[model samples]
Target: MSTVVIAPELQKFLEVVRAELSDLDAEEQREITDGLVADLTDLIDDQGIEALGDPVAYAAELRQAAGLVSARKQVRERVAVGIRVHAVLDAAKARCRHVLEGLPGDVDELLTSLQPAWWVVRAYIAVQSVLLSSGGWSLSPVPDDSISGALALLVVVAASVQLGRGRLWPLTRWSGSALLRVVVLAINLIAIGLVPAVAGGFENREWDNYDAGYSDGMNEATGAYAVDDAGGTLFASGLPVGNIYPYDAAGNPLVGIQLFDQHGNPIQVKGKNECVYEGPEEVLTDTSRVFFPWSDGAAQRWNVFPLPSRIQGADVAEPDPTAFTGTNRPAVSGFPFVAVPKVSLPGLLTSAATTPPKAFVPGARTEDVNLVESGC
Candidate 1:
């Protein structure tokens, strides 16, 4: 018996199919793989190879045809889900290419067949070109109103003219049409490259937001440093409160040194005028903490000065920075007397005798101080 040599590509393809059908039991897998090797070993032609299409896709088809159960349901589910997702996307892509191909004749024919309707089609092509070249559609719903749009329109119109005159798509006797085509090609290439860039930008933005929150939380849990007015060190909450800025007389940003509170906590400064101060840990409630009727606002102190109007503020009481703690006290719900539990009323409401001021200190008066001036 003569030994039959299998093509390397065929071998590789067979291996991939085997790997994809890993869901089948070991015995079934062996049978399928052996049958595939035997059948493919006999044939070696582009037609035979092309007939298989993608190895992965072929494996899925074979599995379905054989009614073979997957060894791992999770793997099968993932693959099936991926196939479902790609089906619509791939179909849409094919549809777009078909549409582009269906458009009227090449440059030379387009010039000769220039009709009122053809011009409208040309305009649509121009708009689409601008949109693709600029990547405006990727970033926003509306097209960017810029020079890129103008350039895209210009290139498409020129290409259309060349195509109308019965010449090549981009080259009209090596004239402006050729240059315009190059530009259009460049724009398309750049836009395609920018797909990853735009995606990366979004990813980076999300990461930055997450990192900032994490850092703020960590800082709040730990303590921060600052200096007092008398230049003494003091312990303070690690949480950032606000910023401060100091500049030279010439208005240049001064760096190198950081400011501290009277407590000796080191103040963090970024750029020239920007400063970050430490404060209390933040508080969050599952429900809105606001009682609109009684509270003019909630967490009003969170509003940093010299900035835009803040909608909400920080915690009213300083939070325990070391760890997250829950209160045993039942949350006070609803408004005033209606929501208050009658059993807890006495404990909830402070006694009037203890609540009122012992001595009503009216307005400030010089007579109260009884200051005497030295005879001058």
Candidate 2:
């Protein structure tokens, strides 16, 4: 038989097949390599070597097919992960929407009562700014919460303006209709009451005390003391203590004293001494500086003690001792005591009772107290 010369292109293809089969068993490698050579030769004869396309392209296609199987498996795994992530995100979005929609009708009712005005404008701006900054735009395919909040705020502003203009209870065009007027007035009253109740509930539910002292009591040599609007004690001497330490409203801590009761209750003593430097020691030098002190004293000592007589009355909590700090400052300042009403008393009692007591000893299992005593 005449010797048949292999084309340069066919030689190249065989070389690639040989390299790929190098890692296979000798028998398998020979079988695969020979098969590849024969197939390429037949392809070249059927279509000119050039027409069969680039040798590298053909080799690349084979490599890609082999890798494609592995790649497809990887793609399936990635798709599964993506699906799970999407499902979780979808559930979260639905829950968020439900929460926003479940807001009390009073939220909308209050908005309806508000009269459109500059404060309303400011309120809308504030609400929108909050929503936008909180990722309102990307919340979901539809921004349900952002839209609802905006609409609710708008209604409130409109109602406020109407109430301010005395248009809330307009005299009907029908003359001598006292019955109509009375009915309208009653409806308006009910609506007005509902607005605040709903808004109040929403605020109370969401507003959490940021300071540890506010939520839990501070431990001292004597015992655990509750924090009030005033703050916590800093030193063992009963000086007004703050986490940031001794900074007044102006960021300056004058002469201060901290003391602890025998039971480990921390007491804060502030303000400069009088002419004799022996006058009555004041608890706070300024009203803003006065905080609730936790003690084992009677309920009256607590801020929420003493229920008020009327529901519409002011809170009967103790006034801050540091409220006024000028020349007329009292020798010992404390919050003005107020009466607590049933509505306020129930909440106060519930909070106090539910709150766990602080631990007396350090490293104890107490949930309420985090004593960072100095020199301990």
Candidate 3:
């Protein structure tokens, strides 16, 4: 092997190559650098460094030839993949910088030239503030329906006003007189802070009232329940004065259904949706439906009521004393009924004309007797 003396400039060029090829493995980097040093040592002796062109650019070309990424490009690509969010932000910043750089002058001068567009943004922000205060408008950068929205408006107003006067800060405007600027700055801060607080306070008041109204309306719709066991608890077929429609295990309507009591006598629902003894003159209201103790014994109705209507307590049909077996015969004193005034009058008239009279008064056995007699 011949001894080769590498020149300082050639060594420096090889170092640059090493740096450019740093993304490659140590063994791969050494192989590329050693090959380049061996070949380029004689080239440098024959032709000066100038003939080889810029070292960095030459190193980049060499890196590409070796199927390796250059140091700067590799770093950028790695960062781009690793921090995708930052990459997007950097692209946006670069675009903005390019747009600003394309303008007639530098940053401050460009801002002054594009004053009209900035003012338009400021004006739009101000209009949004007015709408937000009135509870009519909301958008991003300022969270909707939040106290922070008011604060955001104040900040935008402050920045916009300063920008309109070709200044960044209120104090900087009166920079010639430090004391005067300080006083004005303090006063401006006070005004900005106070205005939003006061405005937002009023807006908050309106929203608070709206929320409270909805809450109170819900509370009023669900009336309280009351039970009076006057007749006794046990009955044969129909439920106590409150249960509107009775259903069996199979969900079949108990109306006109025959059921036998503990004594095994055939009990038939003759008419009026109540149970009558086959052999005797006694009438019965079914006591099987018990009040759920969990809801403070509150009565429940189906969600059949139309919305935007109030619910109120209404008087039910008076209880019959002779129907039940136990002394704890319960009566539903009040039923929470939907009071849609628009529908109630017409509904009541239709019900009165169509519904059987015995459905309204289950205690009346005269109709049941006539039905049983007719059937027999």
Candidate 4:
């Protein structure tokens, strides 16, 4: 039987434990090291590398279990400090909100300006929830560019509304009523101005650089080849069809070929415009392209094309004389030709030249195509 090796990080942790335990009774240290090794090995065998959350944490836990007082105290102090910091931030936020409630004029605008401050508190609460909810602590979720842009837009709006109201309130109380209206209108316009820019920012952050790769398809007649769910593998004759080539609409050899599935679906195959006698040397190189069932996102779908194949004993220029015609010529004059000789071959091979696989023929009704989520 083969032995599975422990990861280097785990091995180093064991070494550190061994060093720390050296001050103990010789036999006791050996026994502790052996037990720790056995426990770690079992953990690796069962749960894999995920058994260790963090190397330092793992080491600290092991030290505590082995009765190392100093290490245990250090870990406890770190945890206590973190808890206290979170508590202080939470109290500060509560105080700020209470103060906001007593202030006058457009509470919504004031709240909007104070959102950033509230988020700090909200993030702290979220972390606390994670800690108390049996999952332990987790960091605040990273805001995407879209979220950041939205927040920025909100801030601008809040500032504009506050400034406009402050400027117009005094003017409206005086004789300059028209000037006050103009200020109010200007504030609204400036707030509206953020809409298009916010929309553009949303588009840029979400979709600007995204390029969904090709779709997959398969030969209708021959169901011998297909791609994986992610279209990374090319199965030919129940195996990977190693040779892949892309062609343009004019049938010229291009860089990458679009492959199809058994259901005549086109799949995407990524490649550069370079010719190699060998087949696809890289399969599933990018994590984004890999087909993980858990993450069935849009990027997983592929578009594939058919690669070139060799015709046995046939020259490129000549027609395949082996093709069965309806009428066979008699060997001699007046000799009867075999009547309707059976051709023991695969599906009907039409005399028509090879071409790209047919595109998907969508059903007449939108429901048939399963456009709605209810149908799917």
Quick one: best lDDT, which candidate?
Answer: 3
Estimated TM-score per prediction?
A: 0.20, 0.18, 0.29, 0.19
Candidate 1 local Cα displacement, residue 95, angstroms: 14
Question: Whole-model lDDT for model 1 versus the true structure?
Answer: 0.44
lDDT of 1 at 100: 61
lDDT of 1 by residue, 32-85 (tens): 666676666555453566555688887887887777766576667866866665
Task: Give the per-residue lDDT of model 2 (tens digit) for 284-313.
Answer: 212121123333445323222111111110
Estimate, for each residue in 112-220, the C-alpha lDDT of model 4 and write its tens digit. Answer: 8885564343333332332334542222223232566346445544544444445423453633233444544454455355445444444544443342111122333
Model 2, TM vs. native: 0.18
How many residue pairs clash (N, CA or C atoms closer than 3 angstroms) in each of the candidate models, in the order given? 29, 48, 5, 33
lDDT of each: 0.44, 0.41, 0.45, 0.42
Model 4 has an lDDT value of 0.42
Ranking by TM-score: 3, 1, 4, 2
- TM-score for model 1? 0.20
- Higher-TM-score candidate among 2 and 3? 3
As for lDDT, the candidate ahead, 2 or 3, is 3
lDDT at residue 103 of model 4 (Cα atoms): 81
